[model samples]
Target: TRMRPLMRGGAQERGRRAGTENVPGIAGFGAAALEARSNLEARTAHFLQLRSRLEDGLDEIENVKIIAREAPRAPHISSFIVKGVRAESLALNLDLKGFAVGTGSACASGALEPSHVLGAMGYSASEAKSALRVSFGVQNTEAEVDEFLAALREMTNRNGTLSGRSTSHFTL
Candidate 1:
């Protein structure tokens, strides 16, 4: 059996990964994971507090629905729907303002596919496409969420279209 190994090459990662093992990348990931684990309790508390504040701010906006409002959610992530606007458009508009957001399953990012999870949970295709995912890290602050809400509100005003695309139209 010439091809005993998966790739017929040296076991870069003990026959696990085929490509060369990225030491730096792996190290960085491990460091971040350890840091997150070490601060899990405090970070969870902070994220929960921030999520409440953000949800409250979102409530002040019109035509928006907080997904799973009655369901459980991870403290670090939020998914919502901005009625009458495409999630991609809204996400892009916010990203241009120096904010990062996810429009669908993070693993399928840039694929323009509606989330299977949302679809399976009974959201129509159109509604699923309008879903947006926002994640928070320990470095974030409540004030930042307030600012983000302001930008999002302006971007998806009652007109159902993004406001002026210029930096002047949004305050990050």
Candidate 2:
């Protein structure tokens, strides 16, 4: 696995990355990693709080369903489907509103096909079509989440009403 690749010295990294030695990047990454490890508990709590707020907001809106709600998820990510809206359109509208978001999967952004992740999880074509992903970073705050929710509500409501239709629901 890439995350647990054979332990190698700096020289091996240099060879693989094709750089003499990115001392600064390595040092910075190491520091960030340490900080992340140390702050894991607090960071996780904050993320869960924000995620809960986002989910609550989405619940009040019509035709929005939280995908993988019962599944174990990372602290910083939220994926959902907004009925009657396409993921691409939602992403574009959010971008225009100065909020960065992802649709389907990053790798499948430009493709017309539905997300493989959703398909693998048994979402139908229309359900997958309405997918959107929001990943929060350390810099994100409650105010930012509120703002995003407002923007999403406006965009989705203005577009059309959400249809609560699910072709299939299954766990993978």
Candidate 3:
């Protein structure tokens, strides 16, 4: 005779997951996924536009260089290097000013290791260490970009003098 459905079920196979189901969390996840799917295209376009403006603002700053400027990059990600300042220091200063930024890859933060991505793309250790990453979200605006750039310029100038190194001048 065939086994009963409940009896045939493995001990580890309680519904879809091995552990107890989280009904509320699962429902929330489904709702979030649906909303994300609905807004995906429009959100992506907005991010791309913000990223473009951010890049333009950064490019106009003296002594700042963008990594992989010529390469195909994600529309929402902007990575750059400010001449003569450490990435960690820049990130910290930016944080104090209420703008959150990252140094190199998010995974490599606090590791004191240079970015492997920059290394693979032929950036020197110093160049990679000077890198900053700004990921644009749908909520960012042109005014925010301008404010960030102003803060970045002031911080870079201060750090450059303190470090006693010439500002990085990169052309691609």
Candidate 4:
């Protein structure tokens, strides 16, 4: 239908994209990459540890589906599905409670049309719609993870499920 360069301006990016070279941004990115690469082992271990704690906490929640728990993936992302709740609503609630989370892939257009990632992995449409993508960072602490879990429990349990019904999140 229509096509244009991602960046338009000068002959930057080896004539692929357009736009003048962002020297400072490029330097920052390169520095960050170097730092991350230097700490790859520690970073992976830290994220995996955080992920384990999060998964353990989620395990006690009712009907929470841990997506691809045994599959190969980066240690930082923890994708899951909540039972009887829409992921978008859940993400909003979590945000209100001070946690930033992402919902469906098609949320760009203000629509929560379910995640293609989940669908490709054989999750049902409902499960896909209920998916949340939670990512951990090396700078995050165990206490932060605990705090988020507590907030999650408070949000999910306090307001019930996302089907506009009251649920006792305590036992969940």
Candidate 5:
């Protein structure tokens, strides 16, 4: 493979390595940046409201624990652990039920070890491994958050043990 300069000139980009410009990617990135900057305040408020609702519902579940509940955190993301359930099994079950959830940081997806971030937060290895993350976006609504809350409550209650048998079919 050969490196092609994006601009065929005497010196392009400080005469360093270069390649063909990704026009489409650059355009999409620009569009996204513009959109994000357009209504930033409104988007932040919406995400905060949704996260509040989610946290309230999660609080009613006896076995669920929200990480960093007292610390200031991002309004769009929530991390929690179900006392006796494995995060991977719960995530898969939710996926089958049409909800996408993440078990760990994107950079460490599929890794067997627990998250280092969670460990730094003073969580035990098992608790860190059980962490599940949910994110709220501009496209989400209160109804969707409620539905997700209900589904999570049901799944956690249904299993109710460390047996890790929550992989069974979960309807709704």
Candidate 6:
């Protein structure tokens, strides 16, 4: 019987395994870390501003609650529950309208179960299942955030429960 290394290259692991050093990956990671460190304050302020805008807009919508509103959280991400709509339904509708959104933890991606994090926070199973996560990035602009808020407001208002099928009429 013969066994092959999972990753084959010139030499790796003191010649015990075969793989090449991930030079490019290491370099890219270092570069990203340097960039993030260089403008940490400015980036943080920008993210906070965007998140504030998103939260304010969300506050205007009925039946939507921002999770952990009083808790300190990362500035770039906002998690919320939009009652009467499943997270999957809203995420899929947003995707079809050219917007990318997340439902729960990436590890739980595509799982029909509710978010354990939200459940731990005392949210009901239905509330946890209705959670949506939106993250702001350095490349995102104020206009983009406004657009997303508008789209979300419209979808939630017009689609109601959106339990059966999505009828997203949002554009751009």
Instruction: Score each candidate by Cα lDDT.
Output: 0.76, 0.74, 0.73, 0.73, 0.77, 0.78
Q: Which segments of candidate 5 are over 4 A away from where they belong? A: 1-31, 162-172
Q: Pick the candidate with the highest lDDT.
A: 6
The true-versus-predicted C-alpha distance at residue 168 of model 5, in Å, is 6.5
After superposition on all C-alphas, the RMSD of every candidate to the true structure, in Å, is 5.0, 7.9, 7.3, 5.7, 4.7, 4.0
Number of the predicted model whose TM-score against the real structure is largest = 6
lDDT of 3 by residue, 1-172 (tens): 7444443333555342345557999999999999999999998898778778888988777768888877887878888887767877777667767788878765566567898878888888888898888987677787888888787777665435323233221000
Q: RMSD in angstroms, candidate 3?
A: 7.3
In order of appearance, the predictions have TM-scores of: 0.74, 0.75, 0.76, 0.73, 0.78, 0.81
Greater-TM-score candidate between 2 and 3: 3
> Looking at model 6, which ten-residue stretch has the lowest summed lDDT?
163-172
lDDT of 6 by residue, 1-172 (tens): 7656776665666555767667999999999999989999998999989889988999998889899978998888888888878787788888876788888654455677887777788999898878888887888888988989877876776444653356531122
How far does residue 39 in candidate 1 sit from its true spot (Å)? 2.0
Clashes of each: 0, 0, 0, 2, 0, 0
TM-score of 4: 0.73
Report the C-alpha displacement of residue 48, candidate 4, in angstroms. Answer: 0.6
Model 1, 99-145: lDDT tens digits are 87877555556666777878777887888777778888878888899
* lDDT per residue (tens digit) for residues 1-172 in model 5: 8666655555646655356567999999999999989989998999889888988998888778898888998878888887777788888878866888787554456789988888877888888778788887788999988888877776775445433355731111
Worst 10 residues of 5 by lDDT: 163-172
- Candidate number that wins on lDDT, 1 or 2: 1
Candidate 6 residue-wise lDDT at 70? 83
Candidate structures ordered by lDDT, highest first = 6, 5, 1, 2, 3, 4
What shift in Å separates residue 93 of candidate 1 from its native position after superposition? 1.0
Total clashes in model 3, counting residue pairs 3 or more apart in sequence or in different chains: 0
The 10-residue segment of model 1 with minimum total lDDT is: 163-172
Q: In candidate 2, what are the lDDT values of residues 44-106, reduced to their tens digit?
A: 998888888888898887788899999998878888888777777677667766887777754
**Which scores higher on TM-score, 5 or 6?**
6
